[model samples]
Structure formats: C-alpha cells, structure tokens
Target: MPEIKRQHGKQLFLITNTKQNCAFYRKNKFQQFSHKIHLLNRQPLENWSFVRTLS
Candidate 1:
C-alpha cells in the first residue's frame, strides 16, 4: 500500500466487510471515508470505506 502511495502521491483506499475489520483499520490509523451496501453472492452486506493519507 505504501508503494502505491509513493507512486501516485495519493491516499490509499480500502473497503472492509465487517465492523470489526473497520475497527481494526481505525486502530491502525485509517479513517472512515464512507459506508455502503454491497451485493455479494446474491446477498446484501454492509461495508465500510477507509482511507489512509500517505501524502
């Protein structure tokens, strides 16, 4: 992820499927960017978007 930041000079973005994972990301310094409902395997699921600024 750091490599991408070095190349693009932008923040890193990620989507995680569970709140627990989101909390983990938060603990690691990633901020919540947004939330969305996603369809997976014919089921609807909630996902969290997180971003870590590398610039």
Candidate 2:
C-alpha cells in the first residue's frame, strides 16, 4: 500500500500486475474519488513507475 499526495486529499493507491488482470490495463490502473477506475497509459507526475516489482 502507498499514499499518493493529491490536491484534494491523501489517496491510498496500489499496483496490481496479476496476469488475470492483464487485459484490464496494459500500462497502469488506479482508482479515483471512490470506486471509480482510472486506466493510465503512463504514470502520474510522482516518484513511482507503473512497473512490477518483487515484494
């Protein structure tokens, strides 16, 4: 889990690279406001990339 600094409020975001969800978004996927989905081709202006990492 990670906290994204936004102008509105603090947004809790996560990156999911499950193979089952590959068709969902080719690049990045995120949520906005409540349960809305935000599919992004590139990453936002932040200190993170939309790449998968071993945890």
Pairing residues by index, what is the TM-score of model 2? 0.20
Of candidate 2, the 10-residue stretch with the lowest lDDT total is 45-54
> TM-score per candidate, in order?
0.69, 0.20
Give me the runs in candidate 2 sitting further than 4 Å from their true place.
Answer: 1-14, 27-55
State candidate 1's TM-score: 0.69
* Model 1: CA > 4 A from native: 38-43
Report the lDDT tens digits of candidate 2 across residue range 1-55. Answer: 2322333344334444343444343344432222234456764322221332322
lDDT of every model, 2 decimals: 0.86, 0.36
- Candidate 1, residues 1-55, lDDT tens digits: the string is 7678668867777898888898789998899989999788989999899988876
